[model samples]
Structures are given as C-alpha cells and as structure tokens.
Target: MHNNEILCRLLAAATLALGAAGAHAQGAAGSWFGGIGVTHIAPDVSSGNLSPPSAPGTQIDVDSDTQPTIFIGRMITDNWSVEVPIGLGFKQKIQGAGAIAGVGQIATVRTLPITVFAQYRFFEPTQRIRPYVMLGLTYTYNHDEQGSATLNAVNPINPPGGTQIDVENRFSLTPGLGVTAMINERWFVDAQYAKSFLKTKTTLNTGQTIEAKIDPNVFRLAVGMRF
Candidate 1:
C-alpha cells in the first residue's frame, strides 16, 4: 500500500510539473519581444601584406572586443522570427603580424556592426525550449582609426606628423545557432553564437594599403520578456 501511495504521488508531481511547463510556453507567435544582452566579438584574422614601402611581408593582426547589446525581435510565425541587434561600436586593436610578428599594437579602429537576422526556431509551440538557426546580413562601419607611435617609427612610408589608416566599410553574411529557455510565462533566457565572413582593405594616408580577412565570431547572452 505504501509503495502504491508513493507511486501515485510521483505521478501527480510529474503531471503538475508538465502543466507548469506548458503554461510557460504560451508561444511567442505574433508577439514582440525585446532584451538586453552582452556580446563578445573575437576576430579570427587572415593577415595580408601592407604593400610596398614596408617590409616584404608586412602584415597585421586584429584583437577582440565586447559590449552591451539590445535586441528587438518579432515572431512572424510559430517557428520563425526576425531580430535586430543594436549596440555601441566595438574598438579593435590593430597589431603587426607576419614579418612584424611579436610587435605590439600599431593602431586602434572603432566599428559598428549593423545586422538583421531571420531565424527559424524548432520544436512545438507548447514546448518551453526552442533551438534556432539564423541567417543574417551585416554592414560594419569602420572609423576613428588612429595610428600608434610604433607605426610612425617602423614604417618607411610614414611622413610628417603621423600615418593613419582608413578601413573601408563592408558587408558580410552571418550564420548562427541559438537556444532559448522559458523561465515562466513571460520571461526567458537566450544564448547565441554566430560567425561573420568579413574582409576589408585598409589604406594608410601615406598611400599604403593592406588587405585582411577578419572573420569574427560573435557570442551573446540575454534575458528577455515576451509581450
């Protein structure tokens, strides 16, 4: 009798738990959601030559940056959504590579990546957890490029006060994966990872140019509410 009583209690608890999970799901379809997140941007660089007037193999490397981000999303269907991420610019460290390897940073460049994503979420609407795949387009605007003392000292092309670089703005395709877990009827936690296939040319005011492939990996974590 005692064994049967315990079995009945366990089943009751499980039923209640499933009921709560179902209540949390409420399906975000046709709803608007917004969240605040923190993002990390790490560059995976394929450095290239700094052209003539520099070393035969004068190349450069880039470093990572992190910032707070805000995102707004709309659920177009039970399993699809669109998201836009907004944030302040990220500052990147431009350092020497290849022939100038081991040399420290030579410049600082600030960039703002504007991206729009179309995501397809998986799983039933009644489930509290969903995993998603996203495809996005991004345009990164590079500006405020300032050269370091190292650049002026080492480059034969350096003239007058100093030599600064200008990195052209470019567009990239971003593909990503993410998951969201509902905590209750109104709140959830989300985590995502994406990669941008980006490349650009940097021109020095002194008439030197270098090409680099800065394929960056982006990671984000956030808590959000659905309305």
Candidate 2:
C-alpha cells in the first residue's frame, strides 16, 4: 500500500510541473519584451581603394579598433523584433606611402556607429530559451584623423611639413545572429554576434581621399527584464 501511495504522489507532482509549464508558455504568448546588452567589437580591415580622389601610388589599410558598446532591442511579436544600437569606435594604424610624406605612416581616426536590425526568433515563445538571427543597416560618422604628416619636398631647411586632415561620415550594411534565454516570467539573458560589410570614402580638406571599408565584427552579452 505504501509503494502505491509513493507512485501516486510522484504522478501528482509530474502533473503539477506540466501544468505550470503550460501556463508559463501561455503567458509568454503575444507579450512585448525589450533588453539592453553590451558588446565588444573586433577589428576589420579594408583592402584596396574603390573610391575616387585616390591617393596616387599609395596603399592604405583602415582597421576598426573600438571599445565596448551598448544596444537596446524590442520584440514585436513571438518571433520578430527590432534592435537599434549606438556606440563609439576608433581606427587602428592607417599605413601606406606615396603621395604625401606621411602617406604610409600610422594615424588614428574616431567614429560614431549607429545600427538598426530586424531579427527573427526560431523557437516557440513558450520555451525558456530561444535562438535568433538578424540582418540590418549600420551608419558610421567618422571624425577627421588629426595628426602631423611630413610633407615631401626638396631641401632640408624647407623640409616637407606635416598637417592635420579631417575625414567625413560613411554608411553601410550590417548583419548578425544571437540567442536569448528566459529565466522566469520577467527576466532573461542574451548573447549575440554581428558584422558590418560596407565601404566608406573620406575626403580631406587638402583634397586627399581616404577610402575606408567599414567592417566591424562584434560580440554582445546582456541581462534584461520583460514586462
């Protein structure tokens, strides 16, 4: 009789667990959610020049080397959402040689990056964990690279001088993927990765052009509460 009683209790417990899970799932349906996350960007380099005012007989490589970033996202439905993030980033050493004296040397540049994304979740809304993929557009506002450049000239006394050059703003397309795990009715965590694939052209006041390929790969981690 004791063994039968134990079996009955076990079945009852299982039934309760299932009932709770069903209710949780139902509660999640059609609910709106939003989250904030932090991300680390990886450096992406541009190959050859594809834009005009090309630096004659010069080869330059531009790399996006920036700091951590923060992003916000909103779920529009069970499987669809939109995300927009704004952050700041810097460029690594710009190296090249030819036209200008400091043509091949390393210089630094700063940028403001803004992105908008559309995402689609793969799992059911009721589940505690969901995986998703996204694609979107990114815009970058580049500040001038201010550094002294040694001018190419004849005579030591009149040695070519160096001056500062400011670059322009650029835009591009960015895409990525991510996953979100629900911890409870009101809390969740997420991890994501994304990359930008586009080219940008920056013209200097001196009529010199810097062709940059804006390619940034990033990783993000965040914690959030869903209302």
Give the winner by TM-score: 1
Model 1, 76-162: lDDT tens digits are 999999999999989999989989888799999999999999999999767787788999999999989999999898799788989
Query: Which 10 consecutive residues of model 1 have the lowest summed lDDT?
Result: 1-10
lDDT score, candidate 2: 0.58
Off by over 4 Å in 2: 1-36, 49-57, 63-66, 88-105, 148-161
TM-score of 1: 0.89
Candidate 2's residue-wise lDDT over 43-71, tens digit each?
46554442333444444555434355555
The prediction achieving the highest lDDT against the true structure is 1
Q: What are the per-model numbers of colliding residue pairs? A: 0, 6
Clashing pairs in 2: 96-103, 96-104, 97-104, 144-166, 144-167, 149-162
